[model samples]
Target: MKILLIILFFVNASTVNAKTFSVTNLANSATSEDCLDYCVDGVCFWLVCGWGCSVKTTPHINHNLPDFVVSSYNEPGENSFSEVQSLDVMKNIQGGNLTTNSKSKRANSGLKFKEASVTGNPVAYAMGQAKYLCNSKIKPYMPYYLSTLDEKMWRSGLSDMLYLSTWVPGMNEVSSNKNQTDEFLKSWGSLYPRSGFLNQKNEVKTASVIAARALEVVSDGGARIYQSSGCTSADCMKKNGKWQMISPVEENSCRAFGIESVEELKDKVDEDGQYGWTAWRNYGCCIPGPGAFIGSSITGCLN
Candidate 1:
């Protein structure tokens, strides 16, 4: 359609002068989290109208597949993935000079900004045969480059500023409060504006905050949501997803935002100011039905 071409034209024009940087090793980043929780969740039924109907067991699979590798860094066009670096070229655009640093005007107010990008994980198909246990919404090498086209919204935080959630107290925040206290142990950042800006002081946590924002932007823009429950289609479940640390500190576990602290990693600091995370999504599937799908029931379903 005409609208789609216009969008792609701007995306290509925005990143025309950017350079790519290869940071993380995709193969080495794999962890046990890929098969986090695999179990038989429920059953599916197939019917042939007037013929007959049959039921089969279904697996409630929780695959921490690397749908996307989101990178957050100080430099523009320095995306961790070499393939999609061009999608982050903002040096030639307006407000391109603004970069994350310790002495920026925003940093003076205890807030720092960074450039973030999300690209399809190259090693997403590493599971090989094991991938048959569940289905994935994203395909390998599928680019969801929102930062390229939404530069103004991403850099200036204008989009989220108009929303009511930005003004609400404790409504759109990323924090860790072990005990219900006034002060949080670790305040990752704010979810408002859904931009590449944050108030986190730590480098690792800052990268994570921006990455989470980028992921949400892409998901909201119609990227397929992971099927985490025992359902034949992703439409049957909610659109929530999780993330797993891949670079700076590779983790074998996947968790929701603000669930864990980045300080727990032994060597949590990266000198290059770059970090990557595996976007994990859950899926449910069962053996192919012989005839038309009628109805089914599942036991011990995990939602």
Candidate 2:
């Protein structure tokens, strides 16, 4: 009986101390806080700077691609914020497209899939049908690929929010993948217009509006909103000197944005017992889009 008790104790302890994987490499961290700080650095560099600097790397910036893939297997729940399931989804779906094609593979919009069947009434058929359904569900989560560009279809201007949130040492054009970035901008034209946003030249500032809008499109209802690094709830104030948070109360990220109090934002708890506010707001993918300036959590109507 004592031996059995000892075995049970070890089993319980192991279960209690199990660690979950993070997309960011934080294995060298000294404490949980230090680990989280490292993840945040990745956020500031790869995510924040990424919007203005590169298009190819943008999809991999955060939990967007991975979490969406995971949600295909199971409905996204409260604790969905912390998980990264990209690799598993890729392995299950398409031999893990081990090269550049993974993100761009689905770029062709007209691709089609075979229908799943379970007519044989066997366990294998059931499993196949289930996998098919999951694949089907991920269809809408796919990101858009720019079709082409027309010089006739361009607009030029910048939002105050975009000006503040985009990369520093700004230039008329910048990106790691210059060819792709220029093509993307040419397809979408200039940044969506806004009043009173300007660059040093006193012209409308141009930021990564296309990519920003894409983030909104893919995340639609799946993620939380956040304040960009230099800005906060205070920056979301209206002309009349009052803050108006347009996102739903449950989805609000900070107190300044019409949430009754910070407590409301902090009240929600994920399945992991992490506060809902922290879970949503702190996740790298949940960064606010340009529309956060206009009191909305998403990039508003683009047309």
Candidate 3:
């Protein structure tokens, strides 16, 4: 009896202390083929007119850097990444009890609510080390946004309702489910409210929906632009940033929201109701020339 009790105690403790995502694992997730989409897009010239023009090749690099690690889970203090577990303490004090009740309600109804946290990826610098690849704008382990702290905006859903896209169909949708013949283009959920509540049925889909919303919030506001020549528009989805699945199932590929289908991701659901993703932004760089800025030409490179 004594031996059995000791074994059970160790097993339970291991389960409680287990971490699904960590710096080491996430750093290993980086793959050369998917993360580094390096290509020479165009050429820049510094024309001296009388003197011969100095031409420099400009490369349009697609770096799948782990800008942020977004975690969406049922438990308030339970984060998949071991580093940001400390942030959960604030979550518990704020509205952890409310989240507990919401979890039970989610199981009963199709409506689901998940608390999400966005933190700087610990392995961002390591992943984005290519010569001309874009530098990460966010620092490792920096807590950008915590859903529990933004109760009025994230929980109430009032601010998001004001947007016309929220009411009108096909406005700011994450993806279109209508005529998506491609399996990787299926819709997961809406992008409005930028909140925790979602009407998704699948557990994996719910976690992804929350993660997407959190990414939209942070990219649009917190870490605006990582690339030097990237778009400066309010919509981060437009040629500014992309997402790479990092946890539960890590993918070497990186793509825009609608490009990657949620249907393919259904099977990779984490049993603990935890999910993670890395935000990848585009960057355009050119080798320096000894002359002033003049003009550049494009080679039809698709960013």
Q: What is the C-alpha local distance difference test score of each model?
A: 0.55, 0.20, 0.60
lDDT of 3 at 209: 69
Weakest lDDT window of 10 consecutive positions for candidate 3: 222-231
TM-score to native of every candidate shown = 0.70, 0.17, 0.73
| Stretches of model 2 off by over 4 angstroms after superposition | 1-139, 143-164, 167-260, 271-303
Model 3 lDDT tens row, 1-303: 532333233334422233466665555554435654556677766644445555444443443455677788766677777777776655334432323232355354567777788887656654444445556566668777677666667766676666665675555566634443332235566777677787766676677668777766675543222212122334333432466676777677776555444577657766567777776555555545545757666675655
Candidate 1, residues 1-303, lDDT tens digits: the string is 432333233334322211222323444444453434556566676655446545443333333455567777766666666666665675565333444444555433446666777666645544422434454555556666446556677777676666675676555556545342322334566666677766766666677778777776665432222222222213321222466665656566666556555566428566556676677555556645566665556676465
| Backbone N/Cα/C clashes per model | 3, 1, 1
lDDT of 3 at 82: 71
Clashing pairs in 3: 184-261
Give the higher-TM-score candidate: 1 or 2. Answer: 1
